[model samples]
Target: LPLKPTPPPFRNHGNFVVSVAELNRWLGERAEEAGAYVLSETVGAKLLVDDDYEQSGERSAGGEASGRDRNAPGRGRSTVIGVRTGDKGRDKDGGRKSNFEPGSDVVARATVLAEGCWGHLTGAALKGLGLAAKDPQVWALGVKEVWEVEQPLDRVIHTLGWPLRPQARFKEFGGSWIYPMNRPGETPRVSIGFVVGLDYADARLSVHDVLQEFKLHPLVRKILTGGKRVAWGAKAIPEGGYWAMPRLHAPGMVICGDGGGMVNVPKLKGIHYAIRSGMLAAETLYSSLKAGSTDFSSYERAVHQSEIGKDLYESRNMKQPFGRGLIVGGAITNAMVVTKGRLPGGHWPTHRDSDQPLLLTDRDKRYPKPDGKYTFDKLSSVFTTGNATRDDAPSHIRIQQRVPRELAEAWKWMCPAAVYEVPEDAPQGSEHVDLIVNPSNCVQCGAITAKGGRLTPPEGGDGPVYQVT
Candidate 1:
């Protein structure tokens, strides 16, 4: 690690890393074994609200399943009861194909939203149900790659500074991590990645490009001397801590995992918090059902009192100080850690990622050009993720196609999947420029959603097929 003054990392013998995708597959199998019907190749397009509920089949007048009456009482007050799966076999023009099948409503007594970071339905529920957090949720973009290294990395290594400027004016907040993937007998492998706060002020800062630059550092290059990059992907993380966590529950519904902003940024861990919150949600739902009650508010209370809430509360103001810059922010973070978040204790405010000012700095010139080996471009990076999105699939990203040149460049560099593009001959002035969107190139990282754009779910079974990430 090439950090200035070489700060000692918080090492623990209990810490270990595993393939998330593989773990998920194992969990799915266990769930199925427990009699849970796991539906594959399906997308939950939208949450089914009780006030506007509509079923797909015909009704028998005797309390049978059917579409809801639009004129029924409580039409304006809605509660999420379940989800509607996305329609399949629709052409690019949205016309029905021979095998077209309309989406069916999978109604449930209680719906739990465990959608990962920046989920589509989670955003809808937050806005439609008025589940507001005290502060707006902030985000970071993480681009990562796995490599088959020649030498095994015995332990985890984290680095700060070097690729990203540490000056207060830069407003860059992030770091890189390198971890050994396999044990003694297995092939030597390592997972290396970099994360950058989405609120960065530079108009041309690219999280992916920064990662390429980070790999070129002497300390990093030594680890990947003769290695070949295997898998690559990007994802957005919610770093707004406790104050930014939305109300965890609504009528007949509960939100869990990254969708509820349970991540503790400093520790760089959220899986445990997500798991704990999930267990509490399950208990609350079970009790509600057994008591024949419709209220799900108990779940929220349980979360606040549980370990997840306490952990987040202690680090609630951690990420906010970093908005001031790495040095001052780092100092404040250290002080807060020692004081257990009691130092400077009031709620700290945060700005939306898009609201951050994009200054016309020359930072873009510092990015390294890909050399084909250790560093690569976005298009090449996307290929390694096993992306299989159909070329003719409807666009899932929503943003103004025309915007100021500065914003255009920001989007162009911000995306790690090469989804956004500006014409090469476009004038570098204040005029609006046409931004081309290659939606098929998207890996469903959800970065756009955090940076002034919206990401809807693509057709089921499309997008990247991550196996070991």
Candidate 2:
């Protein structure tokens, strides 16, 4: 990342590369040392908002309903008082688990959402607060693996272009990354991954297939020639920059990190910003809550005045033009890249990624199936994650009753978990494609939910359990 686009001395070389497990473990240790009463394996069941408008007999300064309108949570600037924790051992199949108990509320002065991308309660909270993203948020699905290689490389690498069809048109903005991992005294290894924009227009674009094809490229195959694969997983990323950010302060809550779309698209970084934002929130809370003040706007203003917002504002226009085409997007991106973001001053309005057309009219697409040794299929890859979702849990995903066949087919390809599929027994050439949902296969990446499916939070501890370094 360069600092020229930014006005002053905020240029950062790059972040130290480390495993997510290791990073989280370190943070957890530090947090405990600082006197935080940390809770594990608990999900925020629901945000608690106040309901005391009648006593005040008032509204917002402009005659809008004051923060306690029970009718519409998304309006009236509701303050989030706290969150209700999901019940332990809770399952939709009533009385199925022996130790079942209903959820309980935990009231607090403030709440912070760093729930990663497409979190279940994020949209609900934003709507409840009556705020919306200026431009729709767009996203991409990243599939990755850790490998112990036969031959070791000592450097980091990034590559774009090729192995992708023109319909997706993500060449200029997103691609593959291969970063070497260093261990105290072990065989040399690397973490490899491919990020394919989820906004792809084809119903045939499978994220696993995209990563598998990326491995076959001449440049990549040489490095992984005889490497042994060790692990696999997938996630979604927010790409829309500054303009896509919604109002940050809720009545009693604030959001940080990727869940708030604070990632810098050009640099493919957000960790530092997340840490900074969290610190800023802490300082504000220390002063405000300690003084018994109800204001939360200070946190938002600090963010806008800090390096995070300036950097985001400077390159605000980078990602959206690609919605038109790579060529058009490329010319604009190239000029900015070459000039350090001085070429653009405004952002374009792009529809939400899901709102884009679901299918390409001229369908002529084929993906090379996995060959086991070097690359494998989705189900097998997910097995490597060791995700053990309950076999008897009820379907937490809800799909509209009469979705068109084309849209249904689109969902089948869009989800990397294989949670969605069409019936194999359908007649040879019939347009009747019945959507089958395998809730057990869901890793809860939230991709299916982003693409028109409604995702209600499942029982606490029902999703994949990733390691904390």
Candidate 3:
């Protein structure tokens, strides 16, 4: 988390790391000083449209689910009036209780969305409202694990190559990271993980299972040999750069951070960009509200002219060529690097990760089994997360009621959480196996979305508990 960690040509340029705990504490002190009332356990289920509030009818909680979707672009003259937080007492399926009262609405002139990659409400608000930019958003799976070790590490480390098999065409698209954490008197801790692009073709390739293989390599295995894994977590990241950023503003709302695709992927950082964006959102909202207007183009103009825009524009085409696999991509990458990222990438069209074809195997090929210490299976990794899902929870993933056998098999291999499965009793190579959902085992890594099982938000406050990841 140092300003820069030897990434080629990478410089902090003032960007730095702050632990989430420190950031939260700082925000709390600031909020308390400013007399801001923070709601911790509430879920903002829907954004209310100013016009629809007066038009009167039973509208669904999310913009798209409701017949009247104000999130859709150019659909109507509806300003975002407020957001409706869900009632805490409602069941998993959202059934109201005997003493049910519709959740209260927080009416604000401006709402800023900082939701990270593929966030439920953010996705709905963008797609339903037709706000997506030229390129579709792409994602990569990043799994992190923390280990408590006896020796202190002198520096941070990052490495590329290995673990990814030959079947995976895009060898350069993923890599490993090892960041050391030192405490004053305690044992040194190392955070290790792998990031694999989701556009990979093989259905059997599991990011969760493969990370164990990454550990078995002598390089990573050495640091982790005597170390005890203390934590585990996973999240999808936005790989699309400026081309994928949605239009930043609408009537009464503006988006910032990951919700607006502010990540500078080539630099491998976004938090600092997010912090800057949040400040811009505040300024844009303040100006609009003071003028008693609903327009938010000021925010868009500011973002396009800010450092965030400059950074994204220069490196916009860097990742797109990698989709063609390592060799061809390597040639293009080197050219761009020499050209300083102004290679006119507009000619190379890019597509969503889901649009990539998946390579299917007949279900008998096997991967090396985990050896417990250097290697691990999926279930045990989920156990270390500490925020494991309840076994009885309702399924939160949305898929076809009766999925085709091929697609079902694909989903089983696609998810790193082991959230989908085929019955043991089903015949091997059979085309009739029912794909079952194990909602409780889910860590919500968002891999299933690439398999066409677009994930929906679980009941509020029901996801991962990050310890040191």
Candidate 4:
């Protein structure tokens, strides 16, 4: 047998890590090169829908779609035909500014949604089209930073159980990652980050602060001894595994990537799945368009029978056990791994992140203050993300101005971008607080959406301008 020659730049052969923002930019460039128009700063605000399924009574009296009609309804069987872009240049009160521009409609035969975790429009499409999964989607907040380090770490590292409480009652489940990002002729770099499940019961737990504490550990400190942080970012991750995945296709549209809950929680990997799902979606769309039909029922079948479905099904019960705490969850996870997910055998129900009740307690974990070097405050971290959000832009976050002290505390601490604040002037001894929202500080991480607030799209390109790798 003849052996195949390995490609040049062999180091890029195996599992590698790259800045997600950088990868996205390169992909966008590649897409543009392929004759696809890549719109920057534009946001898909509303789905242009057709009420054919509803008007035609495609659904039975029980709301189940009739044979071959897969549309389910959060409200009614509204078919997503395309998207409406969000209006720009709106004032804080939503008044048109001098430079105001009305949003435009972009019609298409098919629309593929690849919005990242907990996307606003994704929520709308999921409900409007009745594509929700059996189990509720869960989320975790990830705060990451890239640092220029003196000591170049060659291998990737993952750690668990220090900053987070391990007790089942705490409901804490997460870990941290450290990966080398060394580049030729450039200063040695490494990416360090931490993820915390949003289901934690602690009202004052801060993921950003936890990452700061993670860097202080002697083992982590050694690797980052002379490092200076160059970038910062935060995001929400959908960790609902297979059971939480919604229907992938609806009339005139298909959901792909994280928006479809394609992440494999066990491997902490979703990029490959996202890419693969996108490719499948492209194929499905192409075929549908070629056949002169908007019926994308085939897309759903294609995904379920594809590698994406197979991989997800294998680890279907992976993330649910974590809600019972790391100990029980880890034991079940180990059994599932050993038995190839056959041991669990059935669907383990999950809850939405916001459904977890946060308690106000004197036993809250206290985090160390940022040292301005290894550790950092939320606002300073936002600065590193190159956030250019206008101070006067309309608030895209939707939450009550006044909320219970416990909920207020949760939002204040949960936000890594410091968008929520319990004002200093809040009543001294009240059980409620006036929640002040600083939308300008938001990095559009979508974490708030997981824990009791809604995040809408800002003006096109109004959020953080992530740096290229």
Q: Pick the candidate with the highest TM-score.
A: 1
Q: Per-residue error at 227 for model 4, in Å?
A: 1.1
Please state the error at residue 41 of candidate 4 in Å.
1.2
Instruction: Give lDDT tens digits, candidate 1, residues 1-469.
Output: 3445443224535876988888889989999999999878888987888766432211111121122221222223466778999988787777888888878889998999998897677777765666757477788999999999998888888876668888877789999889889877877999999999899888889999999988888888999989999888899999988877887777788999899999878777778878888899999999998999767888888988988888888888888888788889988887787788899789897677888878768887878889878889999989988798888777777788888888888988999999999988777664889998899999988888777777778888898888777
Q: What is the TM-score of each candidate against the true structure?
A: 0.92, 0.88, 0.87, 0.91
For model 2, the local distance difference test gives 0.69
How many steric clashes does model 4 contain? Answer: 1
Total clashing pairs for each candidate: 0, 6, 3, 1
- Candidate 3: give the clashing pairs: 71-129, 72-129, 73-129
TM-score of 1: 0.92
Rank ordering of all candidates by lDDT, starting from the highest: 1, 4, 2, 3
The local distance difference test score of model 3 is: 0.69
Residue-pair clash count for candidate 2: 6
lDDT of 4 by residue, 327-400 (tens): 78878887887788799788787787888888765433567778898789999989877888999899888777
lDDT against the true structure, per candidate, is 0.81, 0.69, 0.69, 0.80
Q: What is the RMSD, in Å, between candidate 1 and the native fold over all Cα?
A: 6.4
Q: Model 2, which residues run further than 4 Å from truth? A: 1-14, 52-77, 92-96, 167-173, 360-365, 428-432
Please list the Cα RMSD from the true structure of every candidate, rounded to 1 decimal place.
6.4, 5.9, 4.5, 6.2
